[model samples]
Target: MGFQLTADGFAKTIDALKEHYLIYAPVLKKGTGRFTDTDIVRYDFVNEASEIELERKSDYAFKEFLTPLSETLLFFTEDQVKAADIPDKPVLIFLRSCDLHAVRRQDDMYLNNGWTPDWFFKRRRDLVKFVLIGCKKSYQNCFCVSMGSNRSEDGYVFSVETDGDGFACDVPDTGFVPFFAAGQAADIKPSYVTKNDFEVRVPDQVPGAILKHALWDEYSSRCIGCGRCNYVCPTCTCYTMQDIFYHENGKVGERRRVAAACMVDGFTNVAGGGEYRKSQGERMRYRVLHKISDHKKRFGENMCIGCGRCDDACPEYISYSNILNKVTDAVENLGKEVQ
Candidate 1:
């Protein structure tokens, strides 16, 4: 059973939730007409229901809200060390089906994979909950349907969709029912796209030998390594830690973990200036394989949710789905040549 509420009732529900949880939702940031007079959509605190930006896909993923881009790990002072204090308030995040799948992939890495889950991630996981923002249509460049992540059967506390002048919601969590105004039970189905124009053909197997293929070199000439793709990706989890000392004490300060990109320079750098993956092509190859094959070898699922934010965020116009097709062709041709 479900409930339907007008726009005002929806706002009242959100306001009611604010008393218990810190609500985060997609929001539109107006532009100054400097570039193309387009509005930038991203996640922000939703104080009112009208602030949620459901019409367009957000340029940034909600991953950072679960795992921050930069966070202080601990503070140290000679003899004593102190752990960083994390926020205690619970968080309720509104996201799409693909993004919900992204949260699962992230959890697989930070929680389920190892014998001991990452403590920081575990803490964040305990404090966060998800709400599905039903997607009725396809977003440009999205390939989640191909990845089988366009719909989520579970993981969200409740699902909501806009219907005419009112909002219809499937509230599995009974606690949320009090917020809705006087309404009768109505069946509400969440919408999902059946197809996407942009398709990715993943090969049955990307042989280890394919890594030596000359095709990857194309990225060396075209890629500038701006690292926008990683920043916008929901599942890119690599990061680097830095230790900072206080100006006065020189011994007391904090250690921080800052997000990093495989495509960025010095990502593979080590002590004595030794570095692996020297070329942009090498970095690109590593990233692509990790998304499609490497992670799946251990976790049995692709790291990419096929949100296509990487395709949209790339300044150099790189298309990840196109690359997958190229790799597929190269692998097939290689198999034929060997036969």
Candidate 2:
């Protein structure tokens, strides 16, 4: 809400922020190399700035920073329960607006959704800062214009952009009071983005409507059920928990939380060895509708940020946005359908 800064001042501002918080940014890696098994672990980049890939959004989103892919919420031994340490060190994450919006949905789920659990609230309230990155162009399969989550100002503590000689730092009004009160209007205007054209505003009862449409079966028939979309999406937060027993210490063990995808094979296997949504068609319907309908109904926003990583992540070109648009066009043409 202050003056827009030149670019050079922006970089210096964030460089200074690194001292107080660890910055996790889009660091580029080689095409072929060792891949970390953990989705939420820190990324390996070739370099910090110019070397980092900015042309396209990263395949992965910044959700891991807020809700870790694997976290030890609590430890229970012989009826005694104790809390585990969630990452308390303040973290600064660089993210695109879509990813940032997805972060808000997660916030709503953990904090705003209902009873904010003490364990989740503790980690979230204390240890995170956001650095919003600007999107200049659409990459392989972006459809951010459709879902309307491509812009934001809610979460970032320090907003920055490239200035002529250095970097521009825009400290929002609230953040400026204590340390930056005396400074002249050093407000920064980060790079701006041109909004995409298409929009997806499905009806309030879209889950029921989508099920009624024949398109669900048509588009999903090609799905091989690899579950790549769920893995790559910035907003997909479902996870499965597993317990391990140590051979040496029979009484001692550890619990692990792994990211889960409804689309994955064997996704529905339970303790009794039962599976739900056994066919690809059913699995596909479950995922697409959940993203476009069920989540929006509860969160008041579509969970898919329209980052398009799902389309890119898919081996089959099953773009969820395509289905959304097709559904809109079909529903609008119901009169023609009767004629």
Candidate 3:
């Protein structure tokens, strides 16, 4: 069902939903941007309709609610171990079409990649639902059209977009229909970006020789190994475990699963002081290939949903989309060399 709601009606609807679901949406955070005196739009819990930043593309992805940057998996004592408690309240996350597609990538990694689903991730995933935030226009650095993630027809309870002085919603899930009962019924379809400012061409296959390609060397000098890209990427799921011990006792502590980035140093560190992919170039190569090529080999689809948060987060201004094109060019060049 579709509905056309007045601003007040929408606010009331949000108010009613709050009674049951923990709503999260993009919020304008003042003075919290990378630059001084700037604002950034990122995901945060919202209690009302007015709190959601609907005009801008979120600087961060909604993946944090599902796969937090730092999550306590379990608490441990000298002789006892207990899993950390998760909140029983269900969650509702508002996100765009690209991010909706990114959720599939996340599901493939945590729920389907291995023999057993991650218990911690599954618990959170089960409690969560999605709300599609319709994209009226393409944002800067976005290539969702090329990635085929600019439109999401399903996977959300409802789809919402700004309409005049109010909102238009397509409530596919019958369970949520009553929330918008006050609104006027209408035939509403969520808006989607049909095109982006630019396009990215991912090669069908990336050859092994591309690993030694000169394209990666540029990133070695240009990239400072900040790892901001991995942090912002909705699909990057790498994590490292930490055993946090109390100062008074060593055995009693909590084991945390902290987000990890392959671009950063010490990520490859192992026993006996050994480290793999020592250079930033090698790290860059690994990350790029994994996004465009390696992941598809395993999951039958590219991991990158092309939301371009990595481009937005990179302090060094390295363009991941450009790197993907470079990889494509290198693949073509390698084909010529083989011929």
Candidate 4:
């Protein structure tokens, strides 16, 4: 069902939902950006409709709630080990269409990658629900239309967007209908972007020779290896483990799974002081291929949802969409040479 709610009505509905779910939405954080006196939009807990930043595209992904930056898996003593505890309360995450699609990639990694699902991830995933934030217009650096994540018709219990002085909501789950009792029922469909400001051409296949192609060398010199792109990417799931020792003998501690970046230093480090993909160019190649080719070869779909947060977060102003086009052009050139 659809509801046309006044601002007050939506606030009341949000209030009602808070009793059952911990709602998280994009909120503007002032003076917390990379620059001085600037702002950024990131996910945080919200109590009312007005607290949600509905107008701006979130610079950060909602994956933080699911796959936190640093998560303690278990505590260990000399003779005992105990699993860490998490809240029993359920969660509702408000996000855009591309992010909703990114959830599928996350599920594929955590739930379907192996014979058994990750118990830690499963516990959190089971208690979570999604709310789609309808996109009224494509934002800058967005290439979701090209990546086929521009529309999400299902998976979310409801959809919400700003409508003039109030809000428009589409509640597909009957369980949520009672919360909007104060709002007027209306014919409503969630808004979605049909076209982005620009399109990205992802090559159907990347040849083996592309690895040695001169295309990657440019990033080596340009990229500073800050890893901002990987951190903001919703589909990047790499993580590293750390055992935090509490005692001098290192007998008591907690094992933490911290988010890792492929493009960052020490990611490819192994024993004997060895590291693979040591160059920034090689790391960039691995990152891009993992998103577009390697994951697709395994899961049958491209891992990139194309929300363009990576492009937005890059301090060096490197355009991921443009690199994708370069890959496509290189692939075409390689094909012609083979003929």
**Best-fitting candidate, scored by lDDT:** 4
Candidate 1 — worst ten consecutive residues by lDDT sum?
32-41
Which ranges in model 2 have alpha carbons more than 4 Å from their true place? 1-15, 32-55, 79-81, 114-118, 163-165, 173-187, 197-201, 207-209, 247-250, 333-339
TM-score of each predicted structure versus truth: 0.95, 0.81, 0.98, 0.99
Candidate 1: list runs displaced more than 4 Å: 32-36, 182-184, 248-250
Candidate 4 ranges with C-alpha deviation above 4 Å: none
Give the per-residue lDDT of model 3 (tens digit) for 133-162. Answer: 988999999999999899988999998899
In order, the Cα lDDT scores of the candidates are: 0.86, 0.64, 0.92, 0.94
Descending-TM-score candidate ranking: 4, 3, 1, 2
Expressed as tens digits, the lDDT of each residue in 253-319 for candidate 2 is 5566677889878888877888887877788778877777787788777777788778766777887
Query: Model 1 clash pairs?
Result: none
Report the lDDT tens digits of candidate 4 across residue range 250-327.
999999999999999999999999999998999989999888999999999999999999999999999999989999
Error of 3 at 50 (Å): 0.6
Per candidate, the number of residue pairs that clash is 0, 19, 0, 0
Give me candidate 1's TM-score against the actual structure: 0.95
